[model samples]
Target: MNQTIALIGNPNCGKTTLFNSLTGTYQKVGNWTGVTTEKKIGQYRKDKKIEIIDLPGIYSLSATSLDQKSALEFLTKTPPSVIINLLDGTNLERNLSLTIELCALNIPMIIAVNFSDKLEERGVKIDLNGISKIFGVQAVCISAIKTKNLDELIDLAKTTTQKPFKISLTAEKGENSAVKRFSFIERNLDKIIIKKGTTAQNKTQIADNLLMHKTLGLPIFFVIMTLVYFISIKLGGVFGGVIKNLFDDAGERLSIYLSEKEVYPFIQSLVCDAIIGALGGILSFLPQILILFAFMACIEESGYASRIAFLFDRFFRAFGLGGKSLLPMIVSSGCTATGIMSTRIIEGEKERKMTIFLSPFIPCGAKTAVFSFFATSIFGGNALIASSMYFLGVLCVGIFGRILKNLKVFKNNKDEFLLEIPDLHLPNLNDVYMVIKEKIKEFITRAGLIVFCVSVFLWLLKSVGLSGYVADRVEDSFLYVLGEVLKYAFYPLGFCNWQTAIAVISGSFAKEAVVESLCLLTNDVGALFSSSYSAYAFMAFILLSPPCVASLATAKTELVSNKWFFGMLAFQTLTAYTVAFIINMIGNIFVWCGGLLLSLIIVIIIAISLIVAVKILSKSKCCACTNACGERKCKNKEKHSTI
Candidate 1:
């Protein structure tokens, strides 16, 4: 028989750590809350045959945020057979509030106080019997990080029995009551927790004073970001080239072997060009993704992410977003699917939807590979060109966010923002390595499945045409015919070539496919463009457009409406086209006149067009979900409805 055990805790309380320790599952663990935005299930690798479901962290079961809703549903509707309530021993006073609330659930639970190792260093001790007596639950002091007492805690959970109990310790026990529950927890803490006198100044606080300093905070953040990008882009690029050479050599050998074996020409071309060429190009960038994830995991585990949120609270509010929006944008730099899921922590529906809308502009890891390729190939490894694209993305966010905020189409911009800052510590190397490993595994699996399938499909499109099943030349194929129709749409952006047009269209499926498609098309990406300016325009369009298909599915789920999802995609695509057109036109004028006069004239015309677009959008007051014929999805739907 399989047993089910649920791990519950407040955010940043080592719940995921304990789950990982118990099951050896490589679920994401960060020092900040909201890292695990959804429930995850893992079967124990040991002989116990127990299945563990790790629910999202929640302070209580009030069900305001999306994660809270999930937790509440799991506890009330589908309660686990046993729950392991994880807690942070260092912050017992605050962490115990949730513990006290859990006692009211009448489920069999074992309290496992994690971070015991850190508590030991602080000269703090938790009396297990005292805690057990107060909550009528078996309590164990264990450090998930240190792998101490985990087996014992699991054994207790295995045999623990559920019985009806009264939560009478708190006088104020009623629906939605929390004050008396907290007071009860405080009294218990006073009895059970023994702390050494006159504790020393905390390193976290000391670091925060300097790092979060009013004038120095932003600059310090920028410096750290620059270093992260430098290491991932430059250092990772060096290692990527080494891996690329190995894959290239293997592909050459395979191609030669196929030819020598007199394999079917179609099969040879399919395997060599489509499969090896496209898939190999994507796999070669694995080193960069892993290196980037390592640095990001380090930053997240250090507890500095919460501080960055605090630092940006005011700036985010000024643009009609709270600090919560920042986390999704940061996560998007890694993957947009996770980023969209991370928006669950945002309490405001409007902010959450807007966050989902804007996160794709942040340029995900796959896009970073595309940028790296462009930087090295088109711009001769000019780091500024790579970094400038990211900065342009940020600028687009601010500009677009402001436009959306002023439109009055979205409500709930003034929602409350609350964030808990965790104590800082050096990131655990084991945890960081595990995160990198998980990321690499995910990337490889995705590349193997999605990239492989897409590559085969593209190869077929490029290999066959109307006149012949297999074209003599790629330019005579159906893909080139299709791309010719699309290229005219991009003529304004200076990407008039059919090959570049197809590459851009392929990117909508997966951003990594952009470079891979280009590789399969021609060895030199630079030769396909008329000028460096046009190449930059192509890169800009890729950066500013809607993310890949997986992210779109996530957005659709989060938005809960197909109309809004399609609306957002259209909006983002238009924004990418407009931005790329402006950039291309400006670059042309600059090259033609070499001075400010002609550029100024072009800028004025572009500015007028932008202002006109914004004014029309803001004043129209029509439903965003309407079709081009000015008809809403349903006849009864109101005009100016919230998207």
Candidate 2:
């Protein structure tokens, strides 16, 4: 008979490392009860008869967060035959609180007291047998990371018999045996364990003192982020270059073959310029986008992000935002859809709302290609000017969040937070590869399907001109009319032609389409539109525009509200137009009328920003604070009292 063994533990308990060891790459998936969080299952390497379920990393069974609720549901509802409860040996007091609850189920369970090495070096000891006796279950000592005594743990798990069900001793029962279990273990500790050098602990303690210092932590976080962005951008460029070359070669071949075949003008335009132009243009940059995601995944897997969250939590709260929002914002700097999906982890209502409202300010992955191509090709890579746009993204979100909080959109919410700071560790390459593969797959799936259809539709729009193909002349196409209408709006940017506006419109599908469309329009696809000021202005516009239609659709799906979806688009467009106008004006400093208009626009946008900030911080009455930080998933309602 096969045994279904569930590995359960608190977050940062090395639970993932343990699962990686037991499963050895055989993990299968399902999502737990109510949410989209994944459920992992795998056949044991040593015993195919034994199956393992790696539950979410949760601290308790109180059903606090959606993640916690899923774990509790799996434990109470599924009733695995054997539970491998991996408890952090150093934090036994807090960790054992949950073990006491699990013990109530009375199913066979083997406690794997991990991190025993760290405990022994701390001059602390644990009596494993004594804990087993009090809990009426088997307990094994194993270091999952080092594979110490792991075979014995696997053997013991195989033999442990199911104990009859029993309730944990409660305070009402007068014994409170959870504490008794700790006392029993402590009394026998000296005989069972030993201590050695305390160097690692001392070093970590000293580092923590400085790292967690209130005055210095925030500044240190900023310094680290500056370094991460620097490395990510530099590395991404190398990878993007290789991918773009392959795409460029393929595109050249296709265009040359079509020209040789003597295809008609409108048909050629529809096939090459519209359809292939849009999708192929952005698909070429998948390498850079994947590289950026891989870099973030490595950091997250190594646990640097948790410390980052701790360092920034209080700062975000001052703007009525959450520290958890940092991860989404950072991810959004690569892609907004990924950023929006990441919001699911934020527990507080105010925090989640604020993150959703502000995530668009980050320059997504697609837009960065525009920055790279334009910055180097046109301006010879002016680092200071290029970097200013990144800071502008941050400035927008911070100021926007503060301003919105005082409005009807966020009247009754004052954000507050608590976070668990996991220790830094080496990132697993397997995990890194897995993340990169998933992101690349998502990008391809979208580019091939949605983007392909949009490209074909755009081709149809550009094909119906009045003269050569469909009507009297080449200038009367369906797309020409729309482009002509938009020409005046972009007059200040110095590229006031219909082709530039049409490129911006098609760019809603994929950002690189702007450059590609311009290339197609002028029949010189490489380094053709080399106006540096105009290039800078156009890149800025694409960066700040509403995220592609795919991302907006994803936002609607995730938020489950059209209200949030439309609101994001409206805010994004407003910010994009305003930012673009400012950049265009500044770029045209030598042009008299453009420079004057740009100065006036800057003054107006800044004054509006100040008024918005004043309005968001205005106070409001609320009775929601008591349990606001205490719940998650947001499906349950809490009883409230008047403040």
For model 1 the local lDDT of residue 293 reads 82
Residue-wise lDDT of candidate 2 within 386-409, one digit each (tens)? Answer: 566787778878877777777787
Q: Would you list the C-alpha lDDT of every candidate in the order shown?
A: 0.82, 0.68
Question: Model 2, stretches more than 4 Å misplaced?
Answer: 1-3, 20-51, 115-127, 142-161, 164-200, 209-220, 253-280, 377-380, 450-453, 456-476, 482-505, 510-518, 521-538, 581-643
Which residue pairs clash within candidate 2? Answer: 334-365, 406-616, 465-477, 466-471, 466-472, 466-473, 467-471, 467-472, 467-473
Give the clash count for model 1. 0
Stretches off by above 4 angstroms in model 1 are 62-66, 162-165, 169-176, 196-198, 253-264, 467-472, 591-594, 598-643
* lDDT per residue (tens digit) for residues 432-452 in model 1: 999888888888888987777
Residue pairs in collision within model 1: none
Best by TM-score: 1
Q: Best lDDT goes to which candidate?
A: 1
> How close is each model in CA RMSD to the real structure?
7.5, 6.9
